[model samples]
Target: MNVSLILIILLVGAFATYLAGDKLASKVALLFSIASLGFSIVLLNQYNLGENINFINQWINQPNVSFALNADGLAIAMLLLTTALTPIIIYSSFRNEYKNAKSFYALILFMAFAMCGTFLAADGLLYYIFWELALIPIYFIALIWGNGDVEERKKAVVKFFIYTLAGSLFMLVAFIYLYQKAGSFLIQDLYNLNLTASEQLWIFLAFFLAYAIKIPIIPFHTWQANVYQKAPTVGTMLLSGIMLKMGLYSVIRWQLPIAPLAAKEYMYIFIGLGIAGVIYGSIVALRQRDLKKLLAYSSLAHVGLIAAGSYTLTIDGLRGAVLQMIAHGFVVVGLFFASEIIYRRYETRVIAEMGGIRSQAVKFASLFMILVLASVALPTTFNFVGEFTVLYSLSQINVWFAVLGGTTIILGAYYMLKMYQHVMLGETNTKPFADVTFNEATTLVIIVAVLFFFGMYPKPITDLITPSLENIITQINRIN
Candidate 1:
């Protein structure tokens, strides 16, 4: 009934999948991932019924940290998103044959375990440990199973490893400093600290350095495209769909609450940076010839807007960011899976070479088009609900912020549609490109179903997250 059960399931599943051998690895991983998703639903029901599901126990007494896993509505929402997408990502990989398949599938479940812990952990040190643990499996996944030249892949993966690791150290330093002052690493304890303006600013900047690099907003985004292009499709899916949200989630859960003054003082500056990322990512995506790299840039742009929303310090902003986090997670995974389907058939990711796919693959093109529309925030799609709320929040701050952030719609539609034109529309391709099979079609259908269903009825999500977000706003406003 407690949150630790989900973590235990994933950890045990990782080992079970590995032992099942290459022949059964994918199936075992999928089964376990689905089980986690099912159990997450059960926990959600318990939470709705007002049962206590959070776990906290004393650990590391000298530093006064607890082994805490808190499942507030916001954290549960994120946990559900992580759990929901994991099986789809794994299922999407079933068609491709991987070397060392056992390890490949095992790592996917392990990464899920780490990400779930990251979402649930309520102690700062525990959260950081989970955050860093999520990185290790992805590093090996990208370095071993990724595409492109071996040397080039190594360079890209290593850069990502070093870049994120270094940024995280700053966050660790911030945590250590806070622990010194507060004598405990519990989130509630840190949030209660009334630090001076200078202290808050330093802490804010330290946390910003870590999150901005992970979120990779604008100037800190150098490591993104290369890694996305080099990593395998499933690796890319995990990074884009679930991992990127960790930074934005932390901004809401930790940064703004703990350093409300600095966040308030420098709000416009940080929001400006996020808006800048939106414009930059959109423009760069227009120029990408490789499909994955283009999608990577598009992801950067979407998260940028989400980041800007979180900084707005309004319930609308934080809630919209969380909603968009879930929406973007599903859409981006679908887009990448669509590309992977093409790569499997055409054996090329080059946009110049792909054309007339729709003629041969009606179902795939249809599903892909829906995903593209969702990505561009077309009305009635889940993305539109999130994107519209985020823009509205930006507008309340400054019309110009809203104006510039709106460019994602115009530019996004341009590049995404244009990419679709070249890749899916045109005269029938000379080469044979098969349509997606039942497995592939099923995956895309599930994603599309979730998007449309939520798009029409977002109340369930809004209701679940609103109170938690309001509490965060109260905390952020408490000292200031």
Candidate 2:
């Protein structure tokens, strides 16, 4: 299938960049990422034709595993997110020089390959393999090339790695049991399993642990802020932009359909926990003084709402969840990259240490302001579209659910505007604050274009995603 070619280009590009050496690694990586994005767009065009992009091959005899990759609309949407962001990630990093540049860029490409596989794999066993595969490069990316104290960074990255990997074990057990029942690791076969409520409850819990920890729900999110604060900017963008979506995507693709009974039964619990994260993240972000940590919490708040949307299990909720995910991917990366921009210029991330950037760097301040408002979900920004859809979906379930989650509208504005005022609008700081460079401007411009373009005209995305989500709802309802 054509999707396999996309993976091939990424895998080969990873090694090719390493071979290209430090002198040309970053350029090579950027070129490859752009090419990957091009191919992903091609895949998107072919999606409506109902082309067979599913490729199956023998992998393991004992587990009955096969190498299967399929590109449905859901998978393609995730792929678009991955490929679109990779070029921007690499381009943004062109401003920073990392030691072992080849390995660094190569790891980025390898991570893309793994994430693409995670989205495309049609076999449950294959998906599990790729799921674990996606974690390796980010670990080393943050461990070796990351900023902050080495020992502390080590602890943070290790905690993040172990926490996510540990949660994945429970999911493996669920997959194994499903294999025993279905005698096939294919996703469709697992979806067909007639699980009793007891089995669905246990299986749902197993999947919930994995997705919850990755999404870093309220209680499971201890490692998130530290990791985001400590990791390199490129690493942070990947983690927040695409990797976290992996968890949310799993809920739509695997957890809900396969465990329809438990999902419907315990929908309130997922919604409650997700809503709790929304408030908890907002209140904590209100007091955060470090810029990156605040954005980390902001990310928690945004995704918390996305998680709530998914738990609603309606076409509207699921649609809003996926759309918001794509929206947050662009917005969060821009916001985090903005922090990186400030860190490089002012040599500080402490909010109090930064002031009056706009007095000198007017253009940078203006762009930064747009992202801030977008994160706050200002009307006429893409974030508002997703936020409105999700809140409406929640309201349909229960008005109070909408009320609790909607507090982000108020608190998000408070924290984000407060940070903007402190970082960009206060009286002039003594330190030199420069405007964003050409490459940095290019990245931010692309992100802003996507946001506002979709903000005013969201029909294309909603049209593409609605049919698939409707199909998912149909499968889920019929199963129960």
Candidate 3:
């Protein structure tokens, strides 16, 4: 179960492929991603619940940090997600030609390594290093491969980089302060440090700003729509599918437990903001004309619910939030990929430019409809299961809050269905577009299969997450 070895193998494969030549670069990336996925599954099979696995070697003596990597149930779940998506993203991008295919595929592999590191790193400094490392490959991927007005694309990438980095600085300061107090950068060590309410308050605030901006809740979310809209579909998939989860994961693993009293005292304010973001994002999404922007706003709303669920401080709430995080990652990636398929055919992203696609592309329409229904939290879909659990948990806290948060369903349906009607089912106004190609069909079918499979049998995932959620809640209660 040495996960570091998995990462090393992926990087080596990627570099070797880079030297192999442009024609083989994508194939190499796909091979690496597939091998990584297999390794992740093996690691999952070997994991013991309620146990921490750490690999450590001293990295810096002065800072008293090590190259620490650890995983529990939660970390394993995230690792599964990162591995699962990388191959799909690589495969999805294969039809397009890149001038520097080797570098492009290499960067994608590098991003996977960074994401795995972010999930597994056990020391605060190690986590921060991986956290920052994840952004660099994405920055290049977007800046080099993105679409839209060239200047706008560049501006969007820069804005995303600066905003996330700025928030991360606050988190760095919080980590340094904790290290100064606790004399070590290990996460578990900091968790055991007893700090005053005031100290906890500031530390919590620092971490909250970092995670919030990364999650991009409400006002902090200004950079996301542009970034999503401008970045290449692969970059968008990684950002929405796996990268954003890093923020939510940090909140559960690092923020709440490290500052429980502060979290308890300030739970309402945090929950309130999440509630506000949910409603606001839904409303804004309803008005979006571009497919990517629409999906971006919708992602904000989904994350808001997850945030609110976290603040509920209830076992079911946290469990549902974790479930929702995984569910949303899959659903959103499918939605964006679906949109990319249409964009490839029509050469447009505007909803008005699309119509009557269902007439020519039944497979595309059917899959798109299923994904849209999933996005709207329809029953027999994983989204419904996740949202229902979160809402039920919220009901235990405050019925009014549950109702408010649940309005996302109505808004989500309104916007998603509107987009579907405009894009998939209307009078024919242009030449019939070609049906989905084999590669596109294969990608969408796999996404659809996973969506339905998880929707029908969510127990395995729920069971895997429940024990970890219970442990976290137990700690929160002990401190509060």
lDDT of 3 by residue, 351-421 (tens): 88889999998888998899999999888888888899999988998898899999899989999998999
Candidate 1 per-residue lDDT, tens place, 329-399, comes to 99999999999999998889999989999999999999999999999999999999999999999999999
Instruction: List model 2 lDDT by residue over 355-428, tens digit each.
Output: 99999998899999999999999888899999999999999999999999999899999999999999998888
Clashing pairs in 1: none
Which wins on lDDT, candidate 1 or candidate 2?
1
lDDT of 2 at 65: 89
Q: lDDT (CA) for every model shown?
A: 0.95, 0.93, 0.89
Error of 3 at 379 (Å): 1.4
Stretches of candidate 2 exceeding 4 Å from the true structure: none
Q: How many clashes show up in model 2?
A: 0
Clashing pairs in 2: none
Best by the lDDT measure: 1
What local lDDT does model 2 show for residue 178? 97
Pairing residues by index, what is the TM-score of model 3?
0.97
* TM-score of each candidate structure, all chains considered together: 0.99, 0.99, 0.97
